[model samples]
Target: MKNKLLLLMCILVFTTGCKKDFLVQEPLASFSDQDFWTSEASVRAFAMGYYKERFPGFGVNDVGGVFSIRETLNDDYASVSLPGFPSQPTVSGGGWATYFSDIRKDNIFVDRVSGMGMKLGDSATYKHWVGIARFFRAMDYCDFVFDYGDVPYYNRPLTDYDTALFRPRDPATFVLDKVLEDYTYAAQNVKLDDPGTGPRGLVITRDVVDAFMSRQLLYAGTKLKYDPATSAADRVKAGVYLQAAKDAAARLISSGRYAVADNYQKLCSTIDIGATPAVNKEMILYRRYNTGEVTHAIASGNNVNTIQGNGAPKDLVDAYLCTNGMPIKTTAGVNPAYLGDQTAANQLANRDPRLTNTFRTDRFYLQYIETGYSVTGYKCYKFLDEPTQNEAYAVQSFNITDAPIIRFGEVLLNYIEAAAELADMGTYTVVQSDLDKTINVLRKRAGYTAASRLPDMKIIGNLPAVGATVYDDADRDPSVPSLIWEIRRERRLELVYEGFRENDLKRWRKINYYNTQLYPKKNLGAWITKSSVTKALILADINGNVTSPSNTATGSGYLKVSQTFRNATSGFVVDRNYLLCVPTYQIDFYGRNGSTLTQNPGW
Candidate 1:
């Protein structure tokens, strides 16, 4: 009966949804049969399923996909109840339990298919399946450490999970080392590209592995290199990984196949990729969405029609460079001209094209706005496509845009940052050509000129060997070079709300980004004054209803999320918030009267 149940579950795991399929895999003959491993087609299909399940293409409302983090937590988006570091958070949804099925499926694939002979393909083709399986496992662990801190390491499927589940939490270093191991293997062995165009855009490839390794390595190396949480020994080892990150990125960059395409918008929220994948060459791996087949709600979440308002913050707005390639904050300020206009277009005027491309300006989509759903005046435009993203609508699925899961633009970012940060960590100096390869190239893509000659980074070496962090520098971060700051700023602008911001805040220890001290007093939106739209804005939901007119009704400035998160006393406790609270009950159960499941600190 137990084996029967396992067989049933295993079959279900491999059963790809005909509708949800991105790189659809045909089923093996009778999933429970041992002969499942005999066919090369079945093995390839199983590998494709890993891509589908691990980096899932989200729908309008799927956990771990579209609405995953409730974007309001980051500096970019605004929401009703501002988030605070929990004083006593309990029962953080242990990300592992939710992903155990996936890990098991991955393990089974790696274990079963690895030794079996492939009748239909050469050994090289067979290695690709192994690499794909390892990649998924590594990706799962990378995310695991990101959230829960330390979890037991499992390389093979745990058929008797009840007895084995209580294995003690491993140190984060051990888990990250394992992650590096898997990613390393995958990078070397994964197929250069998919077998053909049908799979080329979606299947796991060497470039995808390299890009992800660069990303994961960059994160792991940064956290170890700087964060006070890391031990001195770990800090010493940080360079090894940081250098590895640089190398991984360099391998892909040297290949020269990927480039920052002319249109950054095409890399996101495009229903166009399915029809013309060639145009989105910059996309190393993007989740495909067909109207009836696989779809996501990214459009609804960003566009006016479905109304997931999610206003982009003023600070974020200010991050966009002016047309002359200068920071907007340098020339623009919270004064009468810039802030008082109360019109979205005026607010965005003279800023970078990305600002216009990314945000919905003064043009009221319907005079209908909601306070709870978004930042008051502003709305996001990054993941939105016009004509199709409208209310008249594209399909019942509501979104058919192929979301870019990984892009070469990010790899360039990972490379440049790892090098810059490494330079700070040691004697290695980051020069202008480095900027040319990454940041400056990105600037050109955003349609900026060369006089943008980037600034040189300086090491703000004020951090103590061991203690609470303090900054003598103005920005309150480790005072690195002017160039490094610009690199950081560029990343913030380019990847705003694409799901990297929140993680950026955590790894860089920029928790203060969400804290109130950064803002003058409130989390201000674009400047607004009393006018027809002001009256409308006051009494407007997305449907243009006038129910309750509250918040900035005066002839004043921009919109705002409340002044809670930034306020020190607004229930956001520092240090304690760095990690989330794991449920005490689970800790207790997993502990099982012994010290196996150590909880995250301050939880």
Candidate 2:
């Protein structure tokens, strides 16, 4: 009887295993599936891992460095490679690999969540987690489609023994459909406001999802490939998605959850490293960074003397409308003398205050005075962190600032553009009230006393002539309306240093307009000196009041120094080769599986 009881006990133990609840496991190596996904905390941790997979370094050649790609694609930023500059790729290998890796991790998380059974917690938590997963999946796919075009769709992770390791590329439309499906799911299931978290604009709130949807739809609607041969229904579908995006943005604006920061200086001045809360309302979605964890060394030029020297190009500087809401040409044409002076004080004077926030002018000084770095022509002021510096590289110190991925301001603009595009289809000319709200909000942030009325066709036709009289109409393409062009121009100016211009140029098919041969010819002017006697004296004062003799002498001498000359625009013509080709290694890998992915034409 005793032996029988012992056997029975052993059987029971074998059937119902002992619970392992407190085990810590290292990721990316090996772990038991049953041991991992058993609780809400575990699931949340897995989601964080997905986010970690997507985070790139802050180095100049990393994704943070890609921030300059937009500047390069536009006529706004230029680069001079020296020691420590990472190998420059014809296409961004780091960006490509990081995004693809992000997709892989997101796929793994989605698969894991689907199979796991939740029993202990609220069902809503599980649903919210799933919604967040889908949101990330859609975001990763959107990045891939926009940058690399249609890529292989891997909704699940591959097994080691699976012979189908390689896959064929899907159509861009198919990928877009996947993005829409995920976003739609996220919008429907995710709570508008997560419980206990309050209405934090920094997190993945319902509004952000909607804004992303609008961005995606607008991108699809404008692409020429989505026309007739692709499908008659695509255009209509595009309109629908865009409309949904617009509605979502309008809802957020109405909800009063966010407002543009009060002043242009506030936008730039909020780079304080010691602040208790690093994020501001102006930031929608941003990656948080701390000192020693990651750094923007290359972009900040190793923080040499707190001067990164990553300067913005003159063409972008000229893009900002004068403070009077008139084109630069309106002012420049009236006084050619001001045309040669691109100093922050000269070029930015009487212009949109956003210009000063985005680009450093001679008038603005670095918070650290000893560096004496002034804007040579126009320089980027958006990413500088003057308060924090790595002691080793005084200029290279990594500030604990958050890098914003999306902003509400962008959503407003997206809504206005999309609604205007769809106006005739549903609403006549998209309501002027909606357009005004978007523009006026941004103008207010820039300290504009009042908003201007939308320009009519005749007013647009009279936009100051750029390049030659032949190109005047080119600048004022009435098919899209002059007001729309103005909005786009504002976006170019406001979003200059952020990583959007390159993709924006591709999507709009307007690379030819800015990247023409006439760019160099049109921009022949001497570099504007950014020195002033008062600023020089201030720079010399190490103790905040007493001027250093050396600095005072340099400041006095600089007033007499001749202005330096530098060509602010490139001569490169936008040809078929403007888009990057698939790297040879990727093509080689895909070719083994009987899949032939063609390179971009002329590449």
Candidate 3:
């Protein structure tokens, strides 16, 4: 039997958020802590639960996760108040302990499946389930290292009398190496398609393992390469992880299992979005939200007529390439069709098609569900389905649009970035073929025509060019290479508002990108004609000075709410802010156990 009931069990648990640690998690009770290996079906059900735990999709009712959530901590969003950056440690743990709960489950599953009733070592089914469990354990550790730098590593479920439960933190390099090993096992051993339903694109498969591995390995590689705290010997291992990431992505590309098959808008806002070949063509793995079964508030939050009290900032908006496939701020003035940013229409004119697809062009002025408005003049509709925006079905907690967990689109990006970082590390040179396979494919899918496709990103001597002329963005950070800078810009535009900017900036060791003093555009919003809009507008310049439109002058300026909100805030303290501080409770708990948990530097 295919055990279709497992899917229903999976959907019912969709509302359970990711718990922070193994210490607090209750072991599976219904399936039994004993005889857990009685059948493959039960094992499969246990694995399915990890999906809901780690991948929250669009999240529970009225609370957003993964999709279209406000990533205001990064440069992409601007609102009335600047999102607070991590400045100090909390006496209570900051969710750092929640990962272990799942980690413990992973450990128990692996331990039992191998040593207990399912000791069939060579069986493909046995390998598949164990591989899935370990893959999740790696994912848990990836999240751990990414946030807390160094953390205690565990490979088995601990008992109350276990002395190893009080083990000290392992070096990040050591921990990440273990993560790499687990992902490698999953990638090599997991089945290519679900044994239950072949190529359904909704279950754990070898492709999903490789895709996630590429993302995590790239993060591991970049953190080691960029973080100043990394030891010299550990930094040498960065190239190894980068090479592995590139290899993993290359495997998926060569396998021909997926493609950039759907258009930008269709891929993002569809209902019942997985299972069908047409919809799952681009998605390697996705969470399907059935109406009245498992629903989320992401679409409702992005409703055009709803008051979404946040917006894409000018910093992100300006990153969009002009229609002519050049930056709007090029030194040579290449894109003549580029209208100035005095108003929403003018700003969007002749820009990249993604800009129009992402932000609601017509709703830039205003509309209503009992008087709705965007905090910034620009409103994001990337996740909004226009047909359902005004319906009862699209309101809070009732939205049924599917959430893409891992798609071919993100893997393509991961491939290009890892390849570029490897090139920068002097491991190898990036050729034009690399760009064609990765970045160019994404551009073509983003509404570009054969005649007007973005000029292929050139590597050797030439940076990104339009037609025959090479140009540089006027606002690019001088520390970055022009070629690398252009690649980063493409990533910024392609993945905006998808909760990637903060991590992207961190991995590149460019957290200062959010510092208002360095990039004032972070605090600026969409340009508007102050007199034409009905709302009382507060406009300000980069210096935090409130400027009133002169009586003789046409009232016009950008919304500056974030400028006032962030006026006195110190943004992105480089030394202490890259990694989060280990909560005081964690340290105290270790001390009480007669073990010491060292805090991150400068906390």
Number of the top TM-score candidate? 3
State each candidate's clash count. Answer: 18, 9, 10
lDDT of 1 by residue, 1-603 (tens): 999999997776667444455345556533664677887777776666666655665534334463323454776765456665556656534555665666777788778778774663788777777887788888888777776676788788786645676678787788888888888888888888777424655777898899888998888777666578788778766776788789999998899887786666556766767466344767888787765576666666665544544465556676665444445333133322233235666667666566666767655332234432355566666776776654533433457777778888889899999988888887467765676688766656633333432222222342211123221223324455555666687787777667787778777776766775555322555554445445534432212232335543444444444534455566573755656666677777766655557777765
Candidate 2 RMSD to the real structure? 10.2
TM-scores across all candidates? 0.80, 0.71, 0.89
Order of all candidates by lDDT, from best down to worst? 3, 1, 2
Q: What is the model-wide C-alpha lDDT for candidate 2? A: 0.53
RMSD of each: 9.7, 10.2, 9.2
lDDT of 3: 0.75
Output the worst ten-in-a-row residue range by lDDT, candidate 1: 462-471
lDDT by residue for model 2 over 201-270, one digit each (tens)?
Answer: 4356777677677676676655533233346566565666666667767776787866665544434334
Instruction: Write one digit per residue (lDDT tens) for candidate 3, span 1-603.
Output: 357888866665663534344446777664556766667766777777777777777776767565575465767776766665765576774667677777788898888776644454447878887788888889889888987888899998899889998799999888988999999999998888786634457788999899999888998899789987777788778888888898899999988878785467766678866544555688888777877678888888777567866767777788888767788877765467678787677888787778887887764643221255777667778887788777776887888788788888788888888888888888778888888899888877734565445556555554666556678888788888787888888788777777778888888887777666656677777665555333456665645455643331345566665544432255434556778878888889989989998988777
Candidate scoring better on lDDT of 2 and 3: 3
lDDT of 1 at 168: 84
269 Cα displacement, candidate 3 (Å): 0.4
Once superposed on the true structure, which residue ranges of model 1 sit more than 4 Å away at CA?
1-33, 58-70, 84-88, 117-120, 161-164, 274-278, 304-308, 329-346, 361-374, 389-397, 446-481, 517-522, 531-554, 563-573, 593-595
Q: Give the alpha-carbon lDDT of every model.
A: 0.64, 0.53, 0.75
Alpha carbon lDDT at 77, candidate 3: 74
Per-residue error (Å), model 2, residue 109: 1.3
